[model samples]
Target: LVAIPPSLLPCWTIHTSQWSLENTIRRRPLLQLGDNSHRHLNPSTISVTTEREEEPDFADHNTRRSEPIRVDLPKPATRASTEAGGDDFMSSDQPRVVESRPSALTSNPVHEAEDEKDHGTVERPLVGDQVRDVIRLIQCRKCSRPLQEPVTLPCGRSLCKHCLPETHTRENISYPATPNRLQGFDCPYQECGRNHAVGDCGVDVILTKAVDNFKAEMEKARETITTAEVSTHVVIQRPSAGQTGTDMDDETTSRVVKGGPLVAVYTLADSGELDYNSNVTFAEVSSLGDEATAIDNRTFSKVKESVRTEMDCQVCYALFYDPLTTVCGHTFCRSCLHRVLDHSTYCPICRRGLSVSPLLYRESCPSNEHLKTIIQTFWADAVLTRGDALAAEALNRHREFDIPIFVCTLSFPMMPTFLHVFEPRYRLMIRRALEGDRTFGMVLPQRPRTANDTHFVEYGTLLRIVNAEYFADGRSLIETTGISRFRITRHGILDGYLVGKIERVDDISIAEEEDLEANETQQALERYESAATHQSEDSSTSRPAMTTPEDLSKMPTSELLSLGVSFVERMRQQSVPWLAQRMLTIYGECPNDPALFPWWFASILPAKEYEKYKLLETRSVRERLKICCGWILEWESSSWSLSDCRIF
Candidate 1:
């Protein structure tokens, strides 16, 4: 058995010895040398030797080594290098040095120098790249195009061309492109090239801003030009009083010339210079505030070159003069009111029912009429002074022709057909008509009423009274036929009745059939037979054949008249009671077409006053036939039972 010494015993027991003891000895020199120190070691100065005393049970005698020699020198001022070949100094018996502080020097000086370099060293600013990239990525906000140059906004942002100034500068400062700032430019990007403002550097920032601004300015200029070109020119027609082409001998020759009114209202800016002598009526001047200014020699030249143009009437598009308000509270020019009443009895503005007879034209209008008389008085005076020439000039502005007109007065009554009883005045009208050429012109009254007085349609047919009968009530029932459609040129009250200047419409009559034309005669005969038998329940009432010239002439008139009456009666029989009712209500006993025998018969047969009025106003014979046919067709299809039928 081997005896173990106290120090040797610790080495002999496996659990008592440190496992890192050899590793610590080998690595101890590296830690003590610091990270960058260099070491000098010679192989001859250190030697290893083996010594044998007694062999242990598990020990290899050949592997046993002598402890290396230890040397303690003053610690080096610098650390050692791993690449200095100093590994031979590390051994188990020699203690290794431990480092107390990190070394200042490092082997990676090149890498450290690179990390310390400035981040701004990149020659070009990323702002320009960012701007270009952003502009390219986003299409134009307005026109949606990528081809436009990017505008470098003062907000240090960029946008495509064609953006509005309001959109860009609402909150952010925006730089506009102009020549004033193009020479020296500042980077728009914040903190980029902070030494320069937009006009201080040479980076062409000013040029970019200028280009964008120029494009916007050009667009504004183009809009102005387009507006000027598209504006409506006022046309004034001035007629020289009493001047005719045939009256060349007259010294004070009156001529008609057309031009716009001196005052005009404009809503846009006008950049063009004003020329008073030129034909242009008015031009827009400026849009400084909410109000727009326009220039005409008469109105704007005196008021500091800018004045509010008068508000125009909504109906006439002219400065309101003598404005009148309807009961519906709608305002219109006095002249416009007159014209509207000629066409319709309703208010022009609200389309409400109106009584023209009570309409009053006065200087003071209703509260809703914004325009006062002060303005109107001045405008009216100006118009009267200037209107004659203007009207003459405007005369050629519209095509002119003489229009035939007709006028008639209502007369007589048939129950359910005509609601109105014959008044005393219309009886006088019939007596007057009988004393004349049996013809009377129909004219609409100046004012219409819903009740008590007569109202006539604007266009009425001329009437020729053919037959008359005196009734017990001192009323006269007259049969008449329509002559032609006419337009009333002028109307006036005459002898308690309406009288009018009416031009007669010349009829283009179809050629009359010769006596030898058997086919026409047979057709006429058949038409007469159809008319006579149209509504007769008794076959005995069938028309007799006409064999004489007088019969031929009279037969057509009788047949046409009978046909019109039969058509009405048939409509009433076929359950289309409305047609009979309408006819009765319109025509009454008085003939509708009092001038034409056939139309007069048609009107008297239908009891309605409105139906008579329709016949009186109907211009074309063909149209009358069409209307009659429609009624017949409607009657045939209806399910209403037939009632007592009688001719008036």
Candidate 2:
């Protein structure tokens, strides 16, 4: 009833003349040139101003971006709308509603939907480029062709599987997803130009099917063209005078000769309009054809349900949050695949070796982007529910304290520790850790001096896996960085490796009393430094008293850190080869930050493993630093060397 500029709003409305119920639409740009350069953008809120008491949601049906492009919608327009289906398409019953949802296509379908049947699902003929848009959605954005066995990358984009780079793919070497992130090509999408690695790629099952449908549509269109060209013939007439071919006459038509070619005859006779050339075109032909059945609300729901079934992870028997596909052409959820790989490198469904495909790279791999887009497009509510459930599950994972423990040498927070995963049980533990949160407990075995002593020390550091390189014989060399300390509440062995229910070990905050203690320690350290200078100068007096662990422990955190820093400075002055500039670059120089200095000192200190575990037992930063200072003092007093302090 009203005419207005199309650029006023961004709603894409379907024609309601064919069959009116309601249409599925989303908020998309009418004309976006590149990036944020919108042609006619006026992003201001527009709501219905009807003379009603209150309106819970003032947004019209046009601005909703809830579902995918293919949608059948609107349940019923009722004020007391309890149904989720009906809530989406409810527009105001007054004039302001039309302006609220300005259409880019035709007029607003809401008024046209008033004179309609069928429960909320509007049926409109797929006209113009709508059918082609469906085909475009599945096409490879890079190669400008239908995706051939499409592989989804972490960047939420896809290209042909054959198009993936093969430079880093090797059989027995380390995984690119582990030791380092693999270098990749520029992203196909203009919106995202960042490089995405092939090591983080997964086969796209849903897009592959869409490509097949696209192929079928092409074949059908060609057949239609061939039939149209070959199915008809032309009739000609021998004109007596300079006259063109007229209407059919029994006598005249009987004596007429057959035409050479239909096209040529049309050209010679100068036909007004050819029936074949009237209006039909290949681009205008809908992929589903004229006989395409319109889907109602119930049928639309059933279709999504069927697709959801395909999207479910077989291992978890739930909706796939991040689905991944293997080189064996099998697709499964990322976490599910992780669980399967824990036992063997073979695919669970196909029993084919998965070593050919890149392993799960949590830091880089984002699983199947196409599948993820489809899931979010179709089941926005379900995805939110799934995300919440997974988050809770991940939180419970840490809180429940059913953690895998690695019985190894001592480790400290912010310090790196390398381990050789030759033992079968520890390999499984590492796999489980990588799959989950990339963390596990690291503790030293007890000396068993007392009968009450446990198999391993109670206190340990939680190691977060940084990198791992695998061997063909099911062994791996993992580089881990310590996260935090933990104390085991209960312990037991599962499948040969230890599993523990542990509580976190954190430092006691220092107060004024500790500051006073630090001042006293500072005076004592000054006295010792003078005494050591005197002893070195004289050569007749015995060495100054060694600072025992107990004495150093009583000192404040500042004193301990100063002692360690002084020791490192003295060692560097003496030209200790490992403390050279190159070594410092590799291992990092003595950190000026007090919170980090103790761990760095602990990592490089040439103390015994048993002695190092004492650092884990303490809940005070002062005590930990004191332990490191004590080791340096002991090393100096005994004239011991740090020749065995290897970087490995």
Candidate 3:
């Protein structure tokens, strides 16, 4: 629990003794003689004096400005109040003055003095004065006295001259492992408020020095820890079972047999499901025995036959395993199709030229309708049994967990492809998300396909759906904010959509430092404001006025990027090569780069998706900065040389 100082209390105020004459004056309004006179004066008379006359000389002559008017009147004989019905007249006019001692409301020096004494010893210093005094007191940690001669330590502490020698000695001699640097020194003063090591001064010099040393030590420690942790977590790959000796293999085989019949049979059987013997060829099963026996044999034979037949390519009437379908509705097993196209194009079925290359079966036995059904059944069963396990693994691996997956717009081999069709389950998922978090993770397939494909970038940001409107055509327009980067940990098929587990990554140090530095840099950038404003003023072309340092600092990073982008464009249009180059150098070529120069340039230029993605994915700020600087330099040199040569 942190204790807030009494001085820090919201309503704490200095005592009366701490108040100065100026403070008293500010708190109480002055009683003005003019105000009193104004309040007592007749309103009509006041208005007549203020009102202007049409003819000043005539008005003045008629008004008779300063004389008092006197009227002759009859005098009445004076009589004593008792003789003239005393009580009623006395009560009606000339009321008697009641003599009373002054109340406490009136100011009195003695009473004020007593109140001041009761209010406690005059605070030694007012609140503002106390703060300054405290600051002086805290100046030098070693001396525990006001810093008469302030000196800075590399650790950023300010120390008095008297304490510097002792601190320096301790800093030099103290072992790196020692936790206490000021063990030998006692408190600098007997009446010190807090005891501290002589070397552990809270002065700016000492503090800064200590901080630098500490940072160096921490860096070394971190490196060691990282090396040790990484070494311990090394992953070793085991050799294939085929590489082991027969004796070892046989032993493993025996263990499998002991484990279970299913394991033993699967271990020995090719394909793990079927077996063949001379006496039981697939072709000889039809001729087997009498009516009942023959019926049973036929049934079994038919099942096997169906399996074998489906294994052949339905389009070619050959072994169908690894079959592929083209966009033109032509189907072929993998090898046959590769041969027919001659590594070229055109569909074999409809004779329509296939614009896309050969497509591989996304699923095993894709051409077999029965096989597809069987596979789906098995897949559903597997999902039912192991979905929780998969989800848990994905979570641990930092992949998207429990969400509908979509395919990439572009396809490549082994890459997950997005289908044009949005299934009901996925629509439900989207609806649920919009009603709730309104955010989702996207993950790219390890291998992308080139044909009608589904692939995404490896790392993606959390997209916040800002607006979503369903159109009459049944499409949605979604506006989103990219929040943070995430990495995919695992992926699996769930009801025909991809499901993944994703983990969020945060780089705090860089982000915070960048923010601070950006603020400072923006202030420094204000020096260019005059140039910008002058250029704007001189030009007939309309442009935004130069932003103030304070305004630029207050703007969001994104808005700043936009401003920089716009400035760069205007400079380019004006043929202000130096300004354009400077802008390009400052903002990197990419969003993730130290600057946005390159990205801004590329935004104006024609760049491929892959090229843009490369820039977006480049995470190193230093590298991005270097790249932008290089581009700026090249552009500058070329433009300068060209301009010089043109003088001829």
lDDT of each: 0.32, 0.49, 0.32
- 353-444 per-residue lDDT for model 1 (tens digits): 65323223231112211222223211222222122222322232112222212233432111111111166766666665565445554443
Lowest summed lDDT window (length 10), candidate 3: 275-284
* Candidates 2 and 3, the one with greater TM-score: 2
lDDT of 2: 0.49
Arrange candidates, best lDDT first: 2, 1, 3
Task: Write candidate 3's Cα lDDT for 1-648 as tens digits.
Answer: 011222232221122233233233221122221122211212222211111112211221123222111112222233221211112112232332222111111111111221122211121111211212212222344543334434432122344556644332222121111343333243343442222233333223222232233233323433433332111111112223444222322322112111111111222221222111100101112121133232222222232223332333333342332234443333454445644543234555557554222322222112322222222221221112122222332232221143333443211111111122244655654565565555544433345566433355555445444444344554443333344445544445544445544443322222223334345445444454444455644343344343233444433343344444554555567775343443333322323322334444433332243433443454433233333333333333455464443111
Report the C-alpha lDDT of model 2 over 1-648, residue by residue, as the tens digit: 011111221121112232221232221222211111211112122121111122212121113434444433333232221222121122232112211221221222322331231212334433322332333444555554556888766555677887665444221111112322333455666665544444445576655764554355344433443434222132323334434334343113211112112112222222222221111112212343322223212233333344444655666665666666664445776656755654355776768655422335533334566666565555443344344344434343332234778776788887766676887778877777665667778887777776766768878988777656566898776666777787877665666667766666655422212333445564465554555455554332233244566666444454456567777877777786657664454347898666588777766654566777777777555556666777776677564544643211
Candidate RMSDs in Å, in order, are 52.1, 26.7, 45.4
Best by lDDT: 2
Ranking by TM-score: 2, 3, 1
Q: If scored against the real structure, what TM-score would every candidate get?
A: 0.22, 0.36, 0.26
State in Å the error of residue 60, model 2: 26
User: CA shift at 165, candidate 2, in angstroms?
Assistant: 7.2
